[model samples]
Target chain A: MEKIPILRMGDFLLVTIQVDMHDRLAMALQDDLTQKISETSARGVLIDISSLEIVDSFIGRMLGNIAAMSRVLDAQTVVVGMRPAVAITLVELGMSLPGVRTALNVDAGMELLRESLNGHEGIRHGSNF
Target chain B: MAVISSETIPVTSEPDIVFVRRRVRETAAQIGLSLVDQTKVVTAASELARNTLIYGGGGAMQLESLNGPRLGVRLTFSDNGPGIPDIQLALRDGFTTGSGLGLGLGGTKRLVNEFAIESKVGQGTKIIITRWK
Candidate 1:
């Protein structure tokens, strides 16, 4: 069985969740990781779902939840390396991670997170849960 | 109707995840989506089918060819049993009231093109999702 990989980079957390694009584990891991963000008071979250072959509604919702939760924790969340299929799925599900950041790869995601943290008037608290 | 095609899978105590995914993938492929898109559709269908068996106690999935170049698939899972009273809560991750991962509805909702849900307390739920190719 494939395992979800997680790495901590200083105050930032990086999670590599391998998903079939349709498995519940994708969303579950996201949920679990989001909680960690809150508990740790991390400055940023980088979720890499590159191995995911699919992206469904449940996963999208969970991702949105993570982003929202991170905001509540005064942290930023960035979802990186989403496949085209995943993007289409998110569009179809009518799900949008409005305030959350997205990038083509981890490097871009990290750059975005760093910018978010370094920028003045950067932190804002919000939740739709 | 020449344009309307449908297939039904009976729900047993334990549904076949692979079979469900295969069927969804085939249907998605017919719509001219790339391999990646087909995978997404299959994945989304798996989550929904699992829910139908686990939460709904059983249901059916139907695929339909929509207007324009994009093809659409709609799955309606129903059970003559108790329904979800708290839709929002049910959609929340880790809010499952039963065993298994709590990513069913919320995750399934994110997999399709358009999603609509109708349910009543003590009744059942009918989720309709359409995906464009």
Candidate 2:
């Protein structure tokens, strides 16, 4: 069974989706991230999709699920490094990934995550749902 | 339109969805589709491939590289599962019989240059989409 690895940083969980993940792999990452968050008590989560070529509604929804689940687990979720073409296609596909935070790159994503965990709950962006 | 190249890939499992996306991208790129067009068609293929597996109980993806008045790529997803009862309703966003975002059919339509779908209850379902270069 193939699995996407989850790395635990100081106070955050990092996931770099470097492959074109199948549906099951995406779901597994969602489950694993939530469980890792609970176990590590991470304050934030960053998923770098820079290498992902496309994000259909299914993967888009998985991101939303991960974000929502992490919020319930007291962690912030930020998806970074989305290609411009993927963003265009995703929007045209009518999926905005509600409840999911995004950043331009890993550095900015980590910064946003840090801010969210720095007692600035007001800075939380994404998702009115 | 004539098919300059054609290939069929089985869509019986989840990993097959990824293959469909990759193959679509490769064909679309080979046909000189812009990066944006390749992304659009590939994304659309991913959505439909998942539908073939989960809703249609497994099928196959047929890719056709076309050269008739234009260069393009055409993808067909066919499955012999319980077909959709209401295509109009199913085409609406936020409507799904399964645990998905309900963007499989409708959203896929928006990502391609041409879209056609046929379904028969208890028979099967087939979806064809094309993107011109």
Candidate 3:
């Protein structure tokens, strides 16, 4: 019914989450992104979460799942624009989101995605928290 | 200590959890909680609401704006499900009876200024958490 739009920009897919997602919506997103990655053969995914005010463990797990799914499909995912408060809450929630690469903003996220696709293995933003 | 205002939000479905988060955010902000405090309490509400739906087999959250001692937001989630068998284990991080990160109870406690829980094996569970501004 309701869906977050996924935009294709050349070799990357851009997802900007602007809603306070319910659990079902979050799950739908994970499935949709995974399918899109396989179909489009995109090299990277850059999700902009600057609009999200909070991130619980469920949403955190969804992001981690999206990253894991894309990775298996041979695509890189860089989540960018996390608010400072969300980052703080996520860490305190005991989910460091290991293996889910993060960046400061969309520009940095695109750059990180580019670097990741350029054979620069282990291109993480130090600690995601 | 004393509630200035209160209401109960039913957590019967997935959308209800989002509603709970929104209501909690409004109450948190209404009580003049800092931006970061609002985020923390709202996040805590999300986790607990999900727990109510999935584990508690549906429940309700009593939202309260307090005025005694200090202005704050309080949320009390109650469910008449099987209830938590072991509070300590449930509160322990990395231990989940359900398919979750096991951060619901413990992590939620950390986000608030005060936390309390009561459960009966054959009865239900009730958790009350408060965040002061």
Which candidate number maximizes DockQ?
2
Q: Which tens-of-lDDT digit does each residue in B1-133 have in candidate 2?
A: 8899999999999878888888888899888999999999998998888889888889999999999899999999999999999999998877788565457478789889899999999999999999998
Colliding pairs, model 2? A99-A127
Q: Write candidate 1's Cα lDDT for A51-118 as tens digits.
A: 77665545666777788888877788899998886676665545555666899999999998888777
DockQ for all models, in order? Answer: 0.17, 0.73, 0.67
In candidate 3, what are the lDDT values of residues A1-129, reduced to their tens digit? 999999999879999999999988999999999999989878799999999999999889999999999999888899999999999988887889998999999999998887766664445333121
Better of 2 and 3 by TM-score: 3
Question: By DockQ, highest first, what's the ranking?
Answer: 2, 3, 1
lDDT of 3 by residue, B54-128 (tens): 889999999999998999998999999999999998888777875754464788888899999999987999999
lDDT of 2: 0.89
lDDT score for residue A1 of model 3: 100
Q: What level of docking quality does candidate 2 show?
A: medium
**Cα RMSDs, all models:** 7.7, 4.2, 4.6
What is candidate 3's CAPRI-style docking category based on DockQ?
Answer: medium
Each model's lDDT comes to 0.69, 0.89, 0.89
Span of ten consecutive residues with least summed lDDT in model 3 chain B: B95-104
Candidate 3 Cα misplacement greater than 4 A, ranges: A120-129, B101-104
